[model samples]
Target: MAHDILISGIRRWARLPVAGRIAIVYLLARLITTGLLLLAAHASTPQSRFGLSPSMGQLVLGWDAQWYWWVAENGYPSQLPLTESGEVAENSWAFMPVYAFLAKGAGLGEWGAGALLVSLVAGFFGCLVLHRLLRDRIGSSAAMWAVTFFACGPLAALFQVGYAEALFVLLLLIALDLVLRRRYAPLYLVLPVMGFTRPGILAFALFLGLHGILRWMRRRAEPLPARHIVHIVALGAFATVIGFAWQAIAAVVTGNPSAYLSTELAWRRNWLTDPSAQFVPFEGFVRGAEFWMGQAGLPSWSGWLLLIVLVAGAAALLLRSPHVRRLGPEIRLWSASYLLYLLAVFFPQSSTLRLLLPLTPLWGALAVPRSRLYRWGMLGLCLLAQWIWILCMYGLAQTFWQVP
Candidate 1:
């Protein structure tokens, strides 16, 4: 696996050179992140609380991580459909099947267990990937900072708890960096992995397609580059094929093209601004309008922050140096994916912050230019917002997805 290869490479490449400093710093950041995650799990444990105290064993092992476990153990159970709680216990409902597949084959615990295992594995590798990405664009010191901010930042709290985002970001960042390097085939390979990692990946296909079109248009007087067009078409086609393949198989087995959707929770994130969706949207409004308005605004402050960070990241990419400008395609692909997420997912909530996690390391590297005070302040703000978002979403999300 690339993870193993990266660890080996880091050891040799960083042992006798200036790169060693960044390597040490990056490893230290990973340690800090790991420590903080363990501490958070232990400190706020249900054990300290009353009857509802969390099963500390499950806390570290895998219980809150159960949904993914169920999916992997069961493997897209069509007959079961939605569980009594209106939760889908199938592969589709679990969102990403690759992790589940890996977990299942490895004899990991159920989906949650597998997710937890993968989360840890992914988080560690994620730091390494972040270090590599930033090292190329921002030099060693800033690269170390970028890696640190990601693993130790507030988001680390939730990310370490066996969630998909941690693993997902590792793939996204690595793949994006590959794209920036113009390693087209490798990027394409990562693109499919990303596509399966999360539904939001569809945007990447569109972004790549757009880039190819723009490039061709800019050079229309010259003959079209077959390789460029092929890459774009191939990327888009792969995304579509995998997508329909899943739905087609599920539909054949379940008698519903959208069997996974039907099997999932009743939450119906169907793009409708339901009164059920918002996070106290009614608190600030009048009678009828206020309730639905708040419902629509369930994401509240965090949503706006996501928009700002995304825009800021995009702007930063454009204004960067020529060497840095090489990053344009990667940035646009990530930006497009996030934008698709913002639009496709109705009633965005704090969890939406998960979607923004990959962008942190890159943005952290970019912060090297600003004053230290401002950079630290901005980091603080992002961390605070992430904290608030975790609190709000963790407690509230279960409302939509129930456990057996």
Candidate 2:
């Protein structure tokens, strides 16, 4: 009788709208994640951070979350903290202030709990915005599939954590949605706040510039409106300027103009080249690939070859697939720009997949036209992988390699 009721309830939920179904699935995933966290906490030492009556807030406030919380409660140090070697320690400058600052402003007694709440709410609405953007291109069912795949994928567990991804994604989606609708004035307002969230503003600006250029070329014979061109240029310039806002603020505060960039690039210096003293995109990935190859007992050449081949194959598929081709130019360009930003700037670390959450829209292309067996199999693997991520990333108390 209980099994029958469970099946009936699921069938009823499946009949809901795309956003509704996604919300239901997301809540279930959260429940499972929280249960796992509690069990792990029970098994941990009494003095461990996760031990005893672990709640959502306590479990999710790990790694970078702590950094954000620190910035929220104590504020950035007047001078950047440095290691014995005169390099900056993992300080607050590396994290953006949007989410943390908002939490601080709310005067939440426990910043971590506030951060977790912000992430949860932002993640849910982010999905709805994504779905709304997708509905016009693909049908509602396909859009629902995209949201489901994203919210339940292997890395979906990160959405529940007190990370910046949920907020970041929400802002970007809002900006993109506005741009697509030709709502320039509102977009101008969102650009600065969006830029304050992360360096993704750079990718977004590139998308706008490239998109505008293509439009100009197509209408070269006809005289385009000067006001339209001005708006386009203004949008691009706004995003570019805002992208540097935090770094400029940090430089002023530290009285060291190079403080922000120097601290950020320091992490890459260890692997790429010490004393390099600048940000070079893709350098981190190259260094990381070499290090990982050595750990896997594989030749460096083999690793490079494999990475190149895989990237090439994925590009080819995206270009050739009819589903991908059907996507609007703005969506295509944004995905391309964001992927390049990742390859160039982001280190291929344990947190890499979590970083790729912004690429959620692209998953819509693959979600459509798949067999039930294939879809279910992929979801099962993703769910199983989530547990492994929790175990290796958070459950263990030792010197875990992955930062999550």
Candidate 3:
């Protein structure tokens, strides 16, 4: 029977390892998460979030969510001149084209419906890829924890309302997986998607491509196989060149290489130049610490609490073993890419919660350390921090989007 064959396929996966299990469960949990949302939707009033239902393509995602909806509903913008002038105002560089393309794919539903379609499939694939990378390099247990952590966090929360984070995280994990498997060709292909999604992703694609090249060059005397090296170099060249080209287009259109950085993300960039722009303003580092420790935006102590544990865990994971260091650069790169983004957002506040969500993979890895006491302690701290952040974010989202 087809049912028996399907059940047998599902049951035959124990050979994969803990990471494989986690990866399997991560995808399984997403289905369950979707089901939970659908059930809640049907149980509640049509407009009442707590009592609504999910039609096949309904959308309930939040924040700037409506913009994607507009694109999905209406289709791409055609450039048109103003009625009284010759000035041409195109769609501008503020919005990317992919979300609209997606909206249209979801029967022209925009971001909300399109997001659900994009993320559910993509994020599920992401879990499988993350698991494969871990299984091939590290143990399955480490992979499982990493995938599990991601599935439980704010990253997963995006499933309810369709957000960029879901798609972003999936592409990120896929690109990393390709590198881990030495499948440079597929990695290069995925990088462009990341670049289109966020300008910062060009940096990620370039760095990963470069690392793969240097790795091949270092293995020059091993006599492994010249054909594979040629393939890798070719792929790296494509990603690096093409990735930068797209970024250049964005810069030229915006009239400054960094215009997109500032024009679209004014609040984020203000902290870099303006002294008074910080969430907690103070003179000395110590004074800044004191100010930050008492701020309302970041919950005073939770920010510092996350900082201490994050750094300590990072050091431990780095020192774990030479094998881990050699085979699993994806783990390090995964954390590093976001660190680059967060360090750029040093002013006002770090947007610590958003910065922390994607690092769930790293946190899960850190939890696997030999220092059981320290690991559990840090884990507890992280869980508490995650809880506080979720409740706070839920309140903020509700206030902004749920207000009738």
Candidate 4:
């Protein structure tokens, strides 16, 4: 009788409108994340960045949240700060203005509260959009399961934090949905906001280009229109311009041509053998591979081999995996382009997983399996991973490697 009652309740829930279902899922996920955060705060030591028994505000506003808050309080510097050795130090230029300014405009009295409000709201809407993005490609049940995975995934803490990721992802999903629907007009507005919200717009621009090529190749069967051709080209150009606009703004404001690049490289310096190394496309990962491998007492060549294997594996998954193919081509193209963008610019480090949050669309592939045991097992693993991440990043933040 109890089992029947529980199944009936779940069936009723499944009948709810998509928005209602997503809202419930998002709320429950936030509650779980909140509980985990409280546990982490309880376990925090004196050596942790927030110290023992830190408040929820402290946990939310810690790490990069402080940087966003700083940007909100004081706009980017006209003259950049320099280290004792005269290299460009970490400054506000590394953070974009959209999330900070939006939080400030919330008028919540405190920046952290406003930032949290924005993140929570954006994350909820992001889940709704994600469900819509996947519903047609996969079945509704599978899509909902994918949404659950994303909401409760290891990086779920992002939904409650002050970081721009939640906002950036919301905008990204809208932009991608627009692209998939072939509605390019709305993207003009979305692209600028997304570009300013975070550093992933270039990948979107690249995806547009790749998408155009794919469409062109399939024109015989799909009937590509001239108007679409124009929209694709124009939108790609506009996205590229917006992508580089931040760098140009930083350079003009700071009166230094390399202000943004120098500031970004400052963070990478800590991991580089040569602190003064100039920015080189596709070099960061190669260097990062060697650096991490050397730290592990492995041959540098092994790192290169591992990098190659990882790249090939990712390619095989996107191009050949039946599960990923079910998501269709646009998602695969976006994932490939974003990974390429990361390889070109980012150094592998503690923040790598956080940086990969934009790939949330791929969660659909993981949810494609229909076995209840498999689904529940994946959920258990995700929750366990979430606990470990919070423990290291917030609870015991005593080491340099514990950074989020």
- Candidate 3 structure quality by residue, lDDT tens digits, 123-192: 6666666666665555666555555555654436454454555666667777766666666667656766
- Relative to the true structure, candidate 4 has a C-alpha RMSD (angstroms) of 1.0
Candidate 2 ranges with C-alpha deviation above 4 Å: 1-19, 39-55, 218-226, 269-275, 397-400
Q: Candidates' lDDT values, in order?
A: 0.54, 0.74, 0.52, 0.92
- The TM-score that candidate 4 achieves is 0.98
> Model 1: per-residue lDDT, tens digit, 143-198?
66666566556676544455566767888778766655655678757766766665
**The 10-residue segment with the lowest total lDDT in model 4:** 269-278
- In the range 327-369, model 4's lDDT, one tens digit per residue, is 9999999999999999999989989999999999999999999
The prediction achieving the highest lDDT against the true structure is 4
Candidate 2 positional error at 320, Å: 2.0
Better of 2 and 4 by lDDT: 4
TM-scores of all predicted structures: 0.69, 0.87, 0.64, 0.98
Clashes of 1: 10
Worst 10 residues of 3 by lDDT: 277-286
Question: Which segments of model 4 are wrong by more than 4 Å?
Answer: none
